[model samples]
Structure formats: structure tokens, C-alpha cells
Target: MMVSRRETLRLAALGTAAILASHPVAASAASKVRIGVLRFGTVSWELDTLKEHKFDATNGIDLEVVYFAGEDATNVAILAGAIDMIVTDWLWVSRQRSDGGDLTLAPYSTAVGAIMVKEASLIRTIADLKGKKIGVAGGALDKSWLLIQALARRDHGLDLPATSDVVFAAPPLISEKAIQGELDAVLNFWHFCARLEANGFRRLIGAEDAEKALGASGPVSALGYVFHDKWANENPDAVRGFLKASAQAKDLLARSDEEWLRLAPIVRAEGKELAKLRDRYREGIPRRPVAEEAADAGRLYRVLAVIGGEKLVGSTPEMAPGTFWQEPPK
Candidate 1:
């Protein structure tokens, strides 16, 4: 369910106090603060921690969570003044900033997402892709696929076409179509990758390749928390307390698997697919941000521009100033 703006602030303030009582290390707060959160695979950890009482009942701001199909959808919530903050990809956030949205980037979340394919398929490498139909997500599949191809062309010496035999579908259907063999392969983020693996599919390549050894950021790992800059500036104390409690949550997730498992249902939604999504995230997409990743934000913006230009028409994605919030201090 979507959280209204008033309720978001109220709950955030309550959650902040709750976190303080438990940790006692967070910044002091005078009143409650609220945050509206988007629902997506990348920010799933923040959602989990928030839902798990990790942010409630203490010295932290209370977080009210809302699920969205994608960052763009969450952008709607932000525009409505319904959400105070968001955790999403830098690409969409940049676009929002360009749109004159008053949002600020606070911290990096996950990095590049990944691409997956079945082992039984003939698609073996980037060069092997040509006529195969690929399933993609949320109307951005073609753009994402083109982004992958751009990297292959720029760094790996591969030739790609202006278009492909890719199939566009929503998140839930893409995996199912790929599994049913209706599509050659589905390019997706990690949750689907893990689910496919559990169901016997082989990974093609993923954003995890960004481990400093792959000559690339690998698979796009940075996801960051976003919020209204105007609101955040007025609530610096709220921001500090929220991040403080979130830091604890990050540490907790890093050190405990049982805790993650317990919150899986709330985060991913219980079922076979949800189980696979939970496991997929566990294998990759760490709960903490890669602090140094702040440098790569510009590169991500440019890459997105190029792919969106050729693959999308009508308008170009915008890059916003102060779109990414500066990395928090260690």
C-alpha cells in the first residue's frame, strides 16, 4: 500500500524514536520524522530493515514503506509530496533531478544489476547474442538491453544492432516467459537471476562484475536513498537519525542471515517466487553502499543517455544537479 505524505512524516518520526531507544547512538530528535519508500529489488534491504522493527521504537525516524513497480513510479510518489525519501537507481534519480524535482541523493545502495539466461540455451557470450529474443522489465527492458550492448561495444569489441529480438514485459511475467521458453533469455536484476538459478537456469553475466577486478564496475551495484531536498534540509536531524539507525540495520544484515530470512516474507512477499528473489539478493547486492562508488555516478548518467537516445524517442533522460546525495561520512 502507498503511504500518504502526512502519514509518512508521522511514522518516520515515530520510527526514529523507536530506533533511539534500542541503539542509543543515534542523533537526538525533538519530534517524529516520516519517510516514504519505494518497493523494488535494490532497496529491498532498507524496506526489510524498516519493516522488521529495525527502525521502529527508538532514537530513529520511522519509515513508512510503499511498493512501486520501478523508480519512475516512485517518482510519482515523490512528486505528490507523499514520500520524503526514496532508495533507487542513480539513472532515474538523475532524470528526476533533471525534471526539476527537489530530491537529494543521500547514500549509495546497490550497484549495477545483472543479466541472466538459462544454461540449456545457446546464448553463451555477448558475441553470441543476435537473433535471440530477450525478456526485459517495466518498459525499460530495451533501454537496459541497449545499455548492456553499449558496454559490450565500448569495452569488449562487440557489434550490436539498433534493435533486437527482445520481448518487453512486466517483472512478474518476464521470468515466467523465459522459463517457459517463450523467450530466448530474460535480462533482469539479481532477484530473478537467483530464482532462475534455483529453477535450474545459468547466469549470463551480472553487475557483480564490478568487484575491482573485472575492468568494470561489473554489474551496476549502487542503489541510494533519495528524498525531497527541501524537506531534508529542513530535517537534517531527521536525516542523521535515519541514517544512523540505517547504519545499524546495515551492520545487522551484514552479520546475520537468520534476521534476513525472518524478514524475507515481508520484503519479497512469501511464495516460491519470493523465496527465489530473497535468495538471489542474498548471493549479490550487499546491504551496504560501496562508498567509493560516488565517483561513477557521472559515468552511469552518460551511459544511460546514449542508450536512451537510440532506443527511446520523444525525450532524453535528464541529469540533475545534486541529484546524488553526497556519500555519508564513515
Candidate 2:
């Protein structure tokens, strides 16, 4: 079989192209981004939706959603570069940024937490919380606790520790103890608060109300996607891709009740619990970046400073300039 030189060259080029197409290294590299998430975290819902919908794949993001038992573990992973990003609050981002850590945040959920009381309880207001046994989730350093402390100082002129018998406990235990009549009220995370509401507790004051009481005009982006600045600077497109997919997931949950119903089982919310979650998600969807929520960020900083004093996040009474990553890499 005699082959012409031109034909041999054509066949050789075709073979090379086929090999390149099949070779893993020669194929387009998929962007890998490891994200840390907690089991019961609401951002997990978005991640679940992203996975179920294949939004990450469609958006050209190879997301590795890593699970963590708690924020401390998650923070440790992030600091060690074992994970790239996590759903965390701006308060943490501010603290890290102020301390010269290379971390930044973009809004994930603006979900506001609440203080819930038993329906039959006589605690009608924050002032009435005086001397009552209260369960506080995430301990005395919890963001909600700090906000409540600020709220009390600003509106009622009473310190939270001086007013209430605060007990630091996990959220589920707080709910259980509240139901068993051991605690007068429970201040917990948003998801826990929603579950408590489903179980018949009433919100004494919501995060938004607390912010308002503290004279904040904008809705605080309480929770956001946090990542190391170095990684983000290196992989801008991947970060933007993640945000795009997440925004789509957030919008889907807000725009369609069907999406909520679909994700109910995965998120462990059923019936009334699911309904409450839908309402809360609708309310908490952040329409803009954290940079746009300046007033609320300032409010959060003030609250953190008030309750945590100089120990929590230093004496900086303002949101750190680079704390919120506003512009995505072009």
C-alpha cells in the first residue's frame, strides 16, 4: 500500500487531533473549587440545588462541596487551604480581614435570624426577657447574641447578660429544652428559628427588627460566600462562575414554590416546616452585592464591637474595605 506524502501528513494530523481530544491532560482543564459547607447550613440547600440541577457543570464550574461538622472545623480547613470557600457571615470576614487575614466575602443569603419564645410564655418583649432562662445557640459569641446585645443597649438600655439567664447550647438542644419548658426562650440561627416556628414558637424579635432597632437602614447580608483572597485572585473566573450558579439557585427558590417543595426532603423540612423555610428564603434573598449593603455592614460591625468588645473583632467600628469583594474578575 503506497500512500502519498500529503495523505500521510493529513492522516498524521487527524490522529494527533484525536489523541489530544481523548487525552485527559490535553482536554480543557475543568476548574476545581472546593467549598466547605455544614450539614444543616442553608447554603447547603443552594449547593444541593446546584448539584441536582447540574448548574455548576453548565456554568463551567467543577465544584467540590466539602462537608464540615462546625464552623470551627470549616475555618480550620479554609485557613489551611484544604478548602477554597465556605458560606460564612460578613462578621467573620470582617474579623479576618481586620486581623490581616487574606479572606473576602460575597453575599450568599441575607437570612436574618430571630429570638423565639414559647407561644404560651409571658415574655412579650426584650425587656420581659429579664431573669428568664434563655437558651443561646453558638454561645455568647454568636452573631445573633451580639446583635441582641446591641439592640438592648440601643433601645432598652439594659445589658443582655444582666437581663437574662443566658445558657449557651447547640441549636437543636435549645429547641428541645424550650419545648420541654426548661428554657423560657431560645435565640438561634435562622433555620433553627424556622423549625421552632413550625413547632409553634413565636418570634420575639427578628434580625431585621433588631437591625432596625439599632437604626440600620439596609438589609444586612448576614451570610455570604467566603474565600481566601489569594485563591480568589488566582481563580477569578471560577469564583464568578460559582456566584452565578448560586444566584441562579437563589432565584429559583424565590421565584418557584415548586423548587422549595422539591428541595424540602433534602433540606429535612416538611409540611409547615417547609412552608416556613420557603417564606424565610424569599425574605432573605440578597438582591445586590455586600458593597451595596454598606449601612447594614456598619450596623453589624457596631453590634459585634458592642457585644464582643475588643476581644471578638478588634475595635474597628467599620466594615473593612476589602472585606466584601465587590467586583468580580473580568
Candidate 3:
């Protein structure tokens, strides 16, 4: 039981080295999957995030996350190698695909995007959208498909009218713009959308309409896991794992508001009203996956071709196969 001083020093150094090795910050080298996700809420979700970093705690993803403010910025970050994958709206993915960007929908996420109109407005139906300016939080094509889908359901000729116009605005402000009478309608995801309803706006269209209207013959854009094809092909396992975990996270997020509430501080630290937003994204909205709707993916894409307004990624024709990542295992 007599340890020499030199031996103790040697053991001490080894212990220090071991401690350094286990440090989470250093252990998570940035070289891991740098998923560039959108920080949709004002609060930042991931900050130079690492894999398996417990957002849901259970079934967490093992990757790094770089939060981007919007789709355009997120795509730019992807090109710049700031991160590897993106989980954003499918419409953004469609725009990226049409623009010839190297991104693909390797997995399914959600399909809850919709269009809203003021209940009191004369634009009582999809056909009424003509000649009116619509504000879309995502973009024009999003509104076009929304109107197209809505029209297809109510009347066959009810596709996007050329006479209509679209204005780009933040998702949080879509309803506000409509209430102010500045926008005839709004197309957006659900977080603030429920608020619109509470404030008197009604749902003009939903994703189900996209499928019914297009009759499965066209491409429709919505939401999914968008990542660079080059990276996806090279790292299929990670892609699958990420998707699997995301799917699990989707379930977890649906079952409880605990995770969003726990992560609220990460958002509130930014001085943004994140708790309310978290409640908005969690309690007030629906969370579900769209893996079964591969057919709709193409339909959403075709709808984008009609808008032709945002060439975020590349030309329409270039938005072909080989760009879409294989559907993540269910």
C-alpha cells in the first residue's frame, strides 16, 4: 500500500488525460454530423449542436446542429458546409430541388402546413383568391399549391389563378398582416396559425387538399428532411439514424410538451418571447410525420414548377430523381 510519488504523478496525468477525453464539448468534435436546422422560434435550439444531444432526452439524435434563421439562410449554410442536413418545410425542399440544389428529402417530418383567410373577407373560397395579394410566410409557391389544392377539392378548375399576387412575410406575422387588411390571405405552418383562428381567421386549405386536388399526378411541396445528396449518399447510415431518431422525436414531441418547455430557456435566453412560442409550437399545434405520402412529394414539386417565382435551388427540370434521398426507414 505504499505508492511511489512518481507513480502517483503518472496516475494523476493519466486521470487528467482521461478526464479530458470524456469532456462532452471536446468529445463532440465539430466534424460529427453538422445538421443545419432552422431555429424557427426566436430562441436558438441548437448552438453548434452535437449529435445525440438530448433535445427530447429519449431517442435523441447523435449529431451536431447549426441553427439557421430561415430556409434561404439554412440552404446557404448547407452549401457553405456550416452543417450537413436540414429539417424544414417540404415546400422549401421543393424550391431547393427545382433550383438544382444538392439537397434531398431523405426522411419524413410533418405535413401540417396550411393556408388561412380572414373569415369576414369576400375571399370566401379558393377561387376568390384571384386578383388578391396573399401573404405567405414560406413563399409564393406555397400559397399557389395551397390554393390549387383547395380549388381541386371544391372545384376542378380551382387551381392557382394567374391574376393573384403573393407577398413574403414572417410566419408569426401572417395573421397580423391579414387582420390589418393588408393581406387577403396567409399560407403558413401551424404554430401561429392556431392564433389566427383564435383571432377569427379560418382554414382555407390543408395538405389533404393537395393530394385530392392534384389527383396524385403532380408534385406537391410540404416538409421533410432536406440534406445534401452528396452527404446523404456517403452517409446513409447516419441519414437513416437521424431520420429514425427524428421520427421518434416526433412521437415524443407529440405526446408531451415537456421537451419544448425544458428547452424554452435556450430560446428565452435570446430575449425573445420563447415560452409563448414554445406553447404555440407544442400545445396549440399538431405534430405528425409524412413518410407514407411519397406520392405527394412529387405532387408538391410539380406545384412548385407552376409558381416559378422562387428559383431557390435550380431550374425546374433539373429537380429530378437522384436528388431525393431514400425514404428513411419507418
Candidate 4:
């Protein structure tokens, strides 16, 4: 269930107050980092692993997790100086920097959405989508939808939004409509797409494939850990430790089936659904060098700017410099 915007703000305020009260020395403590996370986000899996194995302590930092009801709430928390970091996309970080904010991104996940249809559906190609009733999860400017549009235009010269009837709604609503047969297809978030796959849906095209078709060198992380530049500079060791701990957690989850089994209750999956979720999560772990990832992101950003226009990329003709954070030399 989703909370109202006002309620979410209230929760963020309370969460922030509690964090400050509990950590009176937070400002001076070089070994502490507070991260604002969505209550049900996949990030919890990594954080859970980090805590379960005491990875934070091993890396010499005190990790704090504050829950937010909505993405906007997390943004609000970070902007108001209530938290040190949050998970978000590079585009948003770029927009902030363009507007003179100092936010930067560290790669989090490369998993992207897919266009899904019922297993028996006849929509086997982009051309087949013409005249179909399509459900889009994140509205017109969604990165996945924009990428699909770019793919359609580049490969088949089809204008997806103009050719198909599109219904824009929340991810959950889009999933429900797709399951009910009201939509011929859906472009939804990765996790929802995974669930649909477990229940018999087929992927017609994945966003990562679309990216490759359009010009990305490889899979690019669409989301990442975002933090202020000044804060990171002030606590370099803490930031590096947190990132190290995050990588360790991902390595553990990638190699250990036993860990996933223990996380089953938290992920709320079983059998095929559990397997699908695990595999998808592992596929998203970032492995490319930071420079390579940044270059790919810059190319994709230009494509998005061209296709999505001012609405998606704002007034920035290119991604802002330092949008992807690079660790200082050891």
C-alpha cells in the first residue's frame, strides 16, 4: 500500500528526528553514514546482507538505514540534510547538478525493465505493437519507455507513442491491468517484470537490449547511490567503507544460495518467483570500471536528451560532469 505525500513527509521528518537523537555525534563521527532508503526497495537486500555478516564493522563504519515511504520522501530527506545518501538515478543527479546542486552518483544496479506480454500473445516484434493497447508504468518520460521509443525509431522507424494507445499509471496498477488482460503489453519496472515472468508473461524486449541496439557499449546501471559531494569529501573513508561494504554484500549475494534462502521471507518470494528475483538481482550488480560506466552513461544520456527532450533531461544538452562518482586513488 502507498502512503499519501503528506504522510510520507511526516514519516521522513520523524525518521530524521529519531536518527539525529540516536546519533548525537553523527556530524563529527567519521565512521558513520546515514542512508535513506525506500521501505520495500531491493537495496534492503544488500543492506540486510551487510548487517547480517557485520560487513559495516569490518569496513570500519557505522551504517544507518532510514526508511522512507516514497522516493520523493527520500529526496526531501536528503535535500533537507536529514540523511547523507539515497538511492536514485543519475539523470536526477545530473539535473540537480545542472541546477547547481552538488549531488553525485555511484553505480547501484544495471537491471532495467522489459516490455512484457502474455505467453500466448502474438506481439513478437516492435511492429506488432502498432495499434495495441500498451500500459506504461512511469509515464511518458520514464527511462525505459524513452529507451523503447528510441529503439523502435532506430530499428523500425516506428513512433511507438503515436502508433500505440498508451495508458500511463503507477507500476503496480500497470502490472494489475496487464495481468487482467486489459493491456496488450506493459513496460514496467524490473522487479514487477520479474514477478510477471514468474507468472507466465514473456519478455518481448528488454530495456538493456534496447540500449545496446541504440548504442550503449554494454549494460548500464540506471540507478545508483546518490550523495552530496561535500559530504563525501569530508568523510572519504566513511564513503569508501560504505561502498566497499556494499560491494562485499553484493559478492556474497551473488555467490551464496544459502543467503538467498535466508532472505526469502524478506523478499517475499518462493519457488520460481524466488529464483527469478535472485537471478535478476545478480544480473544488476555493477562490474564495469567506473570510467567505462560513465562513458556509456554519457552516450545514453545524449540519446535520452534527443528523444525525451527537455521534459526528461531538463535543459542540459549533456550529462553534467562528475555525475558518476569516481573513487580517489588509494
Q: What is the lDDT of residue 8 in candidate 2?
A: 35
lDDT by residue (tens digit), candidate 3, 1-330:
112223434554544343234423332232246565566542133221212245323333356555555555555454444466665555455554544556667543233556788787777767777778877775544544444544553574644445668677767687678788888877776556655666677778765565556564333334455777777666666666565555555555555555556665554422234443444444422232333355555554555455443343334533355444555455
In model 2, the Cα lDDT at residue 213 comes to 69
lDDT minimum window of 10 residues, candidate 2: 19-28
Off by over 4 Å in 1: 1-31, 38-45, 66-73, 140-143, 155-163, 208-222, 267-291, 310-319, 327-330
lDDT of 2 at 218: 64
lDDT of 2 at 262: 84
TM-score of each: 0.73, 0.86, 0.64, 0.93
Cα RMSD to the true fold for all candidates: 7.7, 13.2, 13.3, 3.5
Error of 2 at 138 (Å): 1.2
| Alpha-carbon local distance difference test for all models | 0.57, 0.76, 0.53, 0.88
lDDT per residue as tens, model 1, 161-217: 434576667767998887888877777655666667777687776544422322334
Error of 1 at 311 (Å): 8.1
Q: Cα deviation in Å at residue 62, candidate 3? A: 3.8
Indicate whether candidate 1 or candidate 3 has the larger lDDT: 1
Candidate 4 — which pairs collide?
A: none
TM-score of 3: 0.64
lDDT of 1 at 152: 65
Clashes of 4: 0
lDDT of 4 at 115: 98
Model 2 spans > 4 angstroms off? 1-30, 315-317
* Pairs of colliding residues, candidate 2: none
